[model samples]
Every structure is written in C-alpha cells, then in structure tokens.
Target: MLLMNEKIKASEVALTGLRGEDLGIVGREEALAMAREAKVDLVCTSLLSSPPPCKLVARGAAKQTDAQEKKAERIQGGAVKTKELRLTAHIEEHDYETKLRQAEKLLTSGHAVQLTVKLAGAKEGERAKALIDRMLKELAPHGTRETGIQVSGKQAAVKVNPA
Candidate 1:
C-alpha cells in the first residue's frame, strides 16, 4: 500500500522513479512538502529498499485501477471450473445420450468437461475407448476437444471446452 503525504512512515525514501520526477532519496518531510506542492500523493511504492521507494501520483488513482481490475475479473468468470462425468463400461445408448447432453451443457456454460471411464479388466479397454470416442463425436457440435483420450492405469479420460 502506498501512503499519501503525512501518512508516509519512512524518515527518508528513495524518491527516484522511472515515470515521475527524480527527487532521489529525500527526507519524508520534504517528500510530503513536494507532493503538496505538486497536488499529488507521496506514495510508498516499495518498502523493501533500504530507504524505501516512493512515488508521487494522483490520489485515488491506484484504488480506482484496483477496483476496475476486480470488476473485469468478475465479468470474466475469474476461473473456469472443471466438470467431471464418469461413465460405466457398459452404458446403454439412451443413458450415454443423456450424459452427452449434460457434458454439452457444462461446456456451453464456460466450464471444461472431463469424461472418464475406468476399465477393470484388460478386455474392457476397447469398450471404454469406444464410449469415449462416441461421446467425442456427439459432443462435436457443442464443444471442442481440448485433450484426447489419456490413459493411466485402467482409467481413460478426455477433456472438452465450449466452442
């Protein structure tokens, strides 16, 4: 946080900055006086330096910028949520279609879809792969595949995102 004018704690601060006037390292009292004369705030930009780095900027500008950034994040979904759907090795056609619709809805709502099928026996791998492939094919109109089938141990998974 940047302190304004009298609120500055450092006795002396490195006032030299790339964007503002070069006051170099000066007493806090003098910096406060300079900020008053310039009608700006004496802000402590860095507290880690030996004398601390301070800058002069218009009051409330930093807070306004921070608020704007937060607003933008809220507008953009901050972070995408991953929706996982697990399928059985032998799902009926109707049940598979229902699951596909659910995955499509998730993608359209700006969420990533994770479809997984776990095989208990080696012979069940083909069936799992087939189910994964069919899901991808049906979901093509609603989303794009972000990841192809990824197999680890006996589980195979895929990822999709809204188009």
Candidate 2:
C-alpha cells in the first residue's frame, strides 16, 4: 500500500533522502512539522526498518511513483492473445497435422488457442467430436484445455490456455 502522512503510525521514523537513502531517525511530529514547513508531504516509505522509515516529498509524488511502477509491471508482462484454428469433420490427416502444429506454435508463444471443428450435419457431428478429442490429446503437452468440448449449432469448439 502507498503510505501517506496521516497513515504513518510510528512515533519516530527514519528519514530518507530524495534518492531514498536513509538520513536518520527523527520524531514523527517533527517530521510532520518539517513536511508542513517545506510545503510537502511526509510519507511512510518502509515499515520494516528499525523505527520504520518516512520521507518528505511533494504531495502526489508517492502516488505518481506507485502508478509508474504498476505500469512498468503491466508492460513487462504482455497481454495474452487468442488465436483460432478451424477444421472440418472429414479433414485429411495432413490438414489435421498442420492445424495441430499451428495451434502448438501459438500456445508456445504464450497465446491461447481456440480449436473449432465445424459439423456439416447431425451425421457428421459425431465425427467432429472425435476430431476434437484427437486435437485435445495432441495439444495437451503444449497447453491446458480450459473448457470441455462444447457443441453449439454446427460447431464444436474448445479453448486451450498456455500452460
């Protein structure tokens, strides 16, 4: 949590410089007074130090710093993209292998894969179900199946998320 002037509880707190180097421990009231006199805020920076730690900085400076840190983390961990691969009930073995390879590639690159097997009629729906089962088996090592095989209308689809 980002600590502020009033949230600080220690009667005495170690003061910190602008670069976060420790200055020394001082009475909390004096620190508050110094911040007030300097027309800035007194912020609690570290809670595990000997007397806890505080810093005097301009108002909103701590909040801005916190926001920047969070933004950096979000950017470091990129967003997950979802890629789809489609197949038919009577797909050739070579085409099935190609679809599996594409799905594996997407999963290895930290993307989710949506596998879809379209059925032309009720008669072909059972064959589509078998195809989906084979796909799940082949792709298990690359990703985890997030949902069970679901058949809606003429489509049987499953979602696989990166492991």
lDDT of 2 by residue, 1-163 (tens): 7777877888889898656667788988888888888778888877777698788887788899987776556446887778889899999999989999999888877788989888888788778888989888888898899898898888999999876
> What is the lDDT for 86 in model 2?
88
Which residue pairs come into collision in candidate 1?
none
The weakest ten consecutive residues by lDDT in model 2 span 67-76
Per-model TM-score, in order, reads 0.51, 0.53
TM-score, model 2 to reference: 0.53
User: Which digits, one per residue and each the tens of the lDDT, describe model 1 over residues 6-96?
Assistant: 7778899989542666878899898888778877777777668779888877777766766666545643856668899998788888898
Q: How many Å off is the CA of 153 in candidate 1?
A: 1.7
Segments in model 2 whose C-alpha atoms lie over 4 Å from true places = 1-78
> lDDT (CA) for every model shown?
0.79, 0.84
